[model samples]
Target chain A: MSKTPIRLTVNGLPHEVAVEPRRTLADALRDDCGLTGTHLGCEHGVCGACTVLLDGEAVRACLHFAIQADGHAIRTVEGLAAPDGSLNPLQRAFWENHGLQCGFCTPGFLMLATWMLEQPGPVDEARLRHVLSSNLCRCTGYQNILTAVRTAAQELGKWREGATPA
Target chain B: MKCPPFDYHAPRSQAEALALLARHGEEGKILAGGQSLVPTMAFRLARPASLIDINRIAELDTCRAEANRLRIGALARHARFERPVVPGPTGALLARAAEHIAHAPIRTRGTFCGSLAHADPASEWCCIALALGAEMRVLREGGERLVPAADWFQAVFTTALGPDELLAEASLPILGPDWRCGFAEFNRRAGDFALAMAVTALRLDVAGHVAEARIALGGVAGTPVLAREAAASLLGAPPTPDRLRAAAALAAEGFEPTEDAQVPADYRRDLVRAMTRRALEGSLAA
Candidate 1:
């Protein structure tokens, strides 16, 4: 019934917004922060369409209140690309591998994959499948998504090994 | 779906949180992880007039493993257990169970104690807690109390927590060196709630006979059911194939299961039997 002032850093940008206690992080990001790349599919916790990074961990923004995210760092799909607008390796891999169809679930997948790629060490097909199981993609049947993630993991690993750092 | 408007208070300390809870009483709900509560609020199933956000209370986020138990603070996220801070078989079991909770994001936000407080009959935490005989520490304005996991869960979506009380932490008993643990569940898909699940910890004596067994099943009852009869049957006896099958059968007995649109009661009972068998076999092999 009351508004709460919140300060959050979104995609390296500091934001201060006054919102009702019930306003979800996803709603704040889309409506208030003007970042619409984060999709809301189920609204409930089931669908990972509202997935975003909170302090570097992938979390369901819809499941978090905007006030709860105060003083936290958030990274949405919009932050995945370079500042100059070049697609990241994961995005490029998805594009080349036909990882997305309909694209409603791509943002969630991208954020989730980004979190996975951020982890240290090599990711095998089994680990990738297990991590990707969290996000659902009605279209593409997931083979292309798996291929895309695998390709991106390889590319990212090579980049990390100092092979033409992106 | 959007959450209905509610007054929010971010308490900085446990005392402040308790005072807020006492003042607001039933009208106030403690928000931790907000994975289950937020979705329920969005669906209008639960509408507390005020929310007491305890995430800022640093004292409530502690996770320490002691000599005999692993003390997990209420705010400790499920993701933490995926790579447990504690060592040994208990931590390994918790990590394995954490992997089966929901999705990665849900795991990142959901808390172990929050899941226990939510008391979903099919929750992995509920089953694990019951199997491990975890003790839930409750705090209030007056004092603090510890409730055993056996008496904590009352029914589906219900627990022993009072309106003015908050679950502060859960202390799960560590598995002894002689004990081995196994967990198995039957879900339609990965990340979905289990239709039926079994968590088992067994210890074998020097003579290759079952020295101790703790078995718990979920989704087949209103609360996580401890298979006392099944566990008792294996005591002092070799867990042979026939003996294990009989015990698993006993675990599915004396319970009335609720039938939902997705799964029938009979199917759930079958799953309970199968899962119990698998869990016992896995523990034995471990």
Candidate 2:
């Protein structure tokens, strides 16, 4: 198959790569672009381990073809840190809350939460739990992950009024 | 797993997309949201020789409300319904049902028209289409047709859509103030397919009696099944708790559920009854 050369803006950095239509965005981000923060747990869409932001919306990177993302802005866990490499609010909250046990699903969670926190309106605990349920973490029992997000939402003033924590 | 290699064409217009579909015929597959198709491709269950990606066709990405209907274009993603695309009870019902679909990431890219075309028995949109009597606007080279919801679905993963036809849009009634809609689904996980689901739309006359009722069930059969007899029983009757329960039981008894090892026939029947009752209660609330 002939390789299709496509340009992708990843973490605000533009890069052009040649890939076949069979190549998924997750594989392309990890291989062609050499950014492996987007993990692929299930090549299919069942697992949310390959979650990333496409044009500011969280999407499963494994569900899309690289050819489909030719002109879109892609954001991964690598983009979640500050310029000086300090942890972002969400990441810092995750660390403080002990959100991860094995850390395999952490990247996808970070990217997914990044999209959630970037939303304009405040989010209640119900909305937070519902959104965070998109990705799975086998080891954490989900309490800490939920707490980490709540903590981040509080620090960023995105928590909804009168909503109590679970 | 990597998808099988295939030729890719991103058409910038519907005409271009139809032309490509016409050229490739059965060898081509239209890539809408790819939430369902891509997974099958990754599993190598479907290996089309070419992919006609219509995402770049900007005109197809719309949800327009006409005088009495809402036309959801092929590119209207599921996430669009999260905010209630239209006003009134119909939009609220769509938003409620959309929340039950797969999680945020999947919903972000999954298209409503694609789900109708894909025709998954457990798809919430399929149930909605059946219960609401939506019209599917199918397009092809040089021609187009509207397939009513009753005749659109054929079987599991199958629809009335021809190999060369593209499901361009789905038109649903705007549902006036007299109409109230309700939807209830049961699934084990947050984003798993529903085991059994029910969608209902009821219109009451000035006397506050049920004038019209459409009830549709999903996941218990190959296609979304309409509870015609059960809906007929609701005519001219007040939607009291006992009346609704009886109708729900009748709905559950009318259909033959497809049983799997995990979900037996009796359990599915029970779910149908429960979901139907809950959906009816939801309509009353609406």
Please report the candidate that would top TM-score against the real structure: 2
Q: Which parts of model 2 are misplaced by more than 4 Å?
A: A161-166
The all-Cα superposition gives candidate 2 an RMSD in Å to the true structure of 1.1
**Which residue pairs clash within candidate 1?**
none
Candidate 1: tens digits of C-alpha lDDT, residues B191-216: 88889999988888888889988999
Tally clashes: model 2: 0
lDDT per model vs. reference: 0.89, 0.93
DockQ of every candidate structure: 0.77, 0.90
Residue-wise lDDT of candidate 2 within B1-33, one digit each (tens)?
A: 788999999999999999999999999999999
TM-scores of all models?
Answer: 0.96, 0.98
Native contact share for candidate 2: 0.93
